[model samples]
Every structure is written in structure tokens, then in C-alpha cells.
Target: MSDTPSPLSRSFTEELWGGIASIFEAILAHPFIRGLTDGTLPEEAFRFYVIQDALYLRDYARALALAAAKAPQEQAIAMFCHHAAGAIEVERQLHESFFRDFGLTEQQVRATPVAPTNLAYTSYLLRVAYAEPFHELVGAVLPCYWIYQEVGTRLATRGSPNPLYRRWIETYGGEEFGRVVREVLQLTDRIAEALTPAQRAAAARHFVTTSRYEWMFWEMGWRMERWPV
Candidate 1:
């Protein structure tokens, strides 16, 4: 873990702006997401993915809520809880609309085994939330917020033909999500500034590992691969 700020964080806000810009560009350039935007994804498979996303969000909310109780500051924890509440709202809407459209039931989603990527991501988060310092946990969780906003914003720009895609994109790309990410990053930077060299290195390793697992989760979902140890 490097104690120094990431090249991207040396200028903090400017780096975040540039980072998000690059991220959105990359997402829009993704072939699968492009296919999704153009309504070329197989209907059944797309539906399956949507169902999975909704289920994942539910679990994500639970994980965040659990972390919130242990966050260092009352305001920070409260914000996390509020974010979880917002996620539940989106989950409900996705359930009522997209799930029904796809003929997916809550029971079916509940019965689905955690994909390897999903397990890796979730387990890492839970471990950070439970055992790491509050600042480190924030660093660990920031990727989730960043990734979704990145994907959602790019997907929105592509103007998906499916109403559901549009809804999902807008929900995440909107001002609310932006605000959350901004707040989290602000808190993370404050903590990062205070870390000892050894602690900073550890925190960076945790963040990078968590990010790699996030990518792994998507790969597993898309490839339908079994967990690979």
C-alpha cells in the first residue's frame, strides 16, 4: 500500500472528475453494454441479468447498512443508511416492474447461489466493514459507488431502447448518486491524508483487491463461470 495519494488523487477533485470521465468512456465502449443499449442482448439473458442485478442490490444494501452502524461518524453512518433506503426503493421498483416483466420471482433469486465474483466482492466488503478501521472500510466501499456511477452514466448516454435499462441508468447516474460518491470520496481522502505509511499501503491493497473482485463478479456473471477458488 502506498502512503502517497494515488496519481488520480494527488489533485483530488480534479482527478475524480477525470477518473469518472474516463470510466464512463470505457463503459460506453464495452461491447456488452453497447449491445444492451441497442436492444440487441438476447431478451431472456438480459432479463436474467436484470433480475440478478436487483438481487445483488438487495444484498448490497444489507451489507452497507451493516457497515453504517460501525462507521466512525454519526453523519457518515446516517448517510450510508439513507443510501441503503434509496436502494431499497429502487429494488422495489425493479421488482415490481422488471422482475415481473421477466417472470422472475423473489424466491427464485433468493435460491440462486452466490456467483464467485459476487461472493468475493461481498465477503471482502463484509470483512472490511467488520474488522477494518472505519476509514479503511470507506475506502473499500468507495469502489462500489464509483463503479455503478461510472457504468450508469455511460449506459444513460447510449440511450437504451429498453425502458428498464433507461430506468436503471437514470437511477444511478442522477444527482443523488453523484452526491453520495462525492461525500464518500471526501471522507476517504480525509482519512487517507492521516494514514501512516504502513497503514496506507494496507488500505490501498484492500481497495485494489476489492476492485479486482468487482470486475471478477461481472466476468463470472457474464461467462456463467463457476467460482474458481
Candidate 2:
């Protein structure tokens, strides 16, 4: 209910983000994330992550596109549509580069079953975009952008010696990505100013749920997760 207020006031998104800081801390301290900084994670794990991310981004873009369709404002639609395109572009370039360099075959990536965690994560976001109120849908989607940028910034400063891992870190930590996140945040704050307390609380719940998924996403890679067929 309470936001991270300045001496004067608190924005709903700011409060919601601050409320989730502990969860964010847990993510920052996770061994999976730590590995990206230390260059100690296994190659299979990294490859699993990259491939899974490519799969995830395709659906993630769809969710953003859905959000654009439902946005109340033209600005929201434009921003979300641009982001939806950017998501796929990032997926194509980033994952393809890693796939080529790391010897990941298209068949291998296509045949790889989506991890349970990943399936659940994307399904939830899609559901939110389809069914949740505008404010709450925005909340569910924001964590993906916000968390990656935060994690990327932290990891970028002390990058792993591994070239592949460094590439991942640098992409998220880069200024262009940061600019996108900032734009989203500004949009979030503007929408939030008009939201009711109950709506804000609901949005906060969506934000927290997605933030947890972000943590699980890293762990999903660390485990090199697969269905036990």
C-alpha cells in the first residue's frame, strides 16, 4: 500500500518496485546469476539458457503485442508495439549469435522442450495481458524489463571472462536497453497516477509474481531443466 516516497510523495510503480526489492536481492544473490559474473557456470547451462531465452522471447513479444492491442492510450500502444518488435529483434540477433558461436543447432533448439518453469512463466504473462486490467497487465510485464536491466547493470560492471557470458551481460546492461526500461517506467508512472488504491495493490501483486518468475528463470538455466520424460 505504501510506496517508496520522497519527502513529498510516492509513485505507485516506485512503491511497487521498492516493495519487491527484497525479492530482487534474492535474485541478485542467486548462484545462477552469480555465475554470470564469475565465468564459472557450465557451458551446457549457458547454452540451455540462450536457447530457452530465444523461445521465451518469441512469446514475450506476443504478450507485448497483446498489451499494445489492449492499451487505453495511443502512447501505450505505440510504446508496447515498438517494444514487441524490439523483443523479437533482440531474440533473433542475440540468440542466433550465441547459437552460431556455441554450436547450437536449429533442430536442437526447436526440439528442446520448453522447460516447465519457462512454460509457466510465459503462460502467466500471456494470461495477464489477455485478462488483467490495463494497469495490472502493465505491472505483470514490467518486471521482465526492469529486472534484466538491473541484473545486467550489476553484472556488466564485473563481467565474466567468458566471452559469451559477457555478451549476455553487456546487452542487458547497455544504454539502449536502459533507455527502453526508463521509457516503460515513465509510462508506468503516468498511468499509475490515475489508478485507485485497490488497482495499485493488484498491480503490485502482478509485479511481484513476475519478479519471482524472473528469479526462477535464472534457476531454470542453472538446472539445465528438462521434462523427466
Candidate 3:
């Protein structure tokens, strides 16, 4: 790990951190997440949601691998890719189990229309992977890493009887997942610190924008609704 704080961390004002924390809190407190904890969601439907998410991760992992090749922070990017691959494995297991339980397959997941939030988030990632500055790419991806850790850890504490919830929570709440979150946070913080004030402001905007979309992603999944008209 780099001993130096990430630019984002160094530049982070109390206000900025508080704003980001607020977004995270909103996402966790979203009704969908609450429903998930209480087991009000139908298992098959929830499993379907997981299937779509797993497919998204599959593409996300590939995008990261490609981005790693051109990353200015080559060493850090490589490490991120390794960590991302591990996340992919977790998703794959979830996908397989969902398939077994719901009699759905990867092909069906591919054929399904993506939720609006799913499309928005994935598009942002691909665009960042292809066009954004190396540090900015890390900034864009950090929320996904951080939010999963936060949500997963919280759900794990809730002790749901649902086996799937147990599995999902265990995967994301584990040490390996925690390590990934730390790595992304450190990378984004480094990016923030290196920026000038104007750049830092821009970075903060990007981070918050992406985070808002993340909340929408979960909301869309939770509601299983198409994007708002």
C-alpha cells in the first residue's frame, strides 16, 4: 500500500466527506434495502436482480482490465484489477446460485433489458475506463466499492435468516472485500490530494454525481421498476 494519502483524502474537507457520507446513508436507508433485510422481496425476483448485477460486474471487470493497460498509475491499476477480479468471482458464485434456484441462466440475464440505473452506472464506468484520466477512473469506481462494503457490513449485522442474504453479506463483509474498499478509497484520496483547488472541486462533483447514480441504482433494483419516464 502507498504510504502517501490519496489526493482525495488530503483534499477532502469536512463538508465534502459529510456530503458523501450523506449519500451513502441515503442509499443504505433506501426502502429497497430495508425490504431486503426484512425479507419482503420475493426470492426469485431478488435472485433475478442479482443475476442482472452479476452480468454488469462481468462487463465491469473486463473494462477495468482494459483500463489497467493504459493507466498512468500502472502499479495501482494492476492491484485494482486483481481486487476487481476477486469481486467478479463473488458475483459469479451469486449468479450460479441464483441460476440453480430460479432456473434462470446467463443467457437470460443477457437478454433482459437493463434497469435504467444499471445502464447509467455501467455506461459511466465504460466511459471513464476509456476516456477519463487514470486517477479519475479510480474516483468514479470508488463508490461502488465503498457502498457495497458499507451496505454488506450493515446487513451482516442484521442476521437475516435468508440463506442468500447470509451468502451475500458474508461475501461482501469479509476481509477480502474490506481490503478492496480500503484500496479504492486510498487511491481516490490520493487523486484528490494531487489536484489543485479547481480540480479538487471538479473531482468532488464527479464523486457525488456518481454516488447519486449509485443510490438510484439500488433504488431501481429494489423497486424492480424501469427508469422513470
Candidate 3 C-alpha lDDT tens digits along 135-178: 56665666677778878889878856677767777877778789
Most lDDT-accurate candidate: 2
Q: Write the per-residue lDDT of candidate 1 for residues 1-229, one digit (tens) a residue.
A: 8688677447333443443454445445554566667876556555656655666677678767876887777887888898788777855785667777778777886787766566667777777777877666665776678877767776777777877667767877788778878787777677666777677666666666655555554545456655467
List candidate 1 segments past 4 Å from native: 1-29, 226-229
lDDT of each: 0.67, 0.90, 0.71
RMSD in order of candidates: 4.9, 2.8, 4.8
Please identify model 3 stretches exceeding 4 Å from their true place: 1-16, 227-229
TM-score of 3: 0.84
Candidate 2 minimal-lDDT segment of 10 residues: 4-13
Collision pairs in model 1: 1-201, 117-217
Q: How many backbone clashes does candidate 2 have?
A: 0
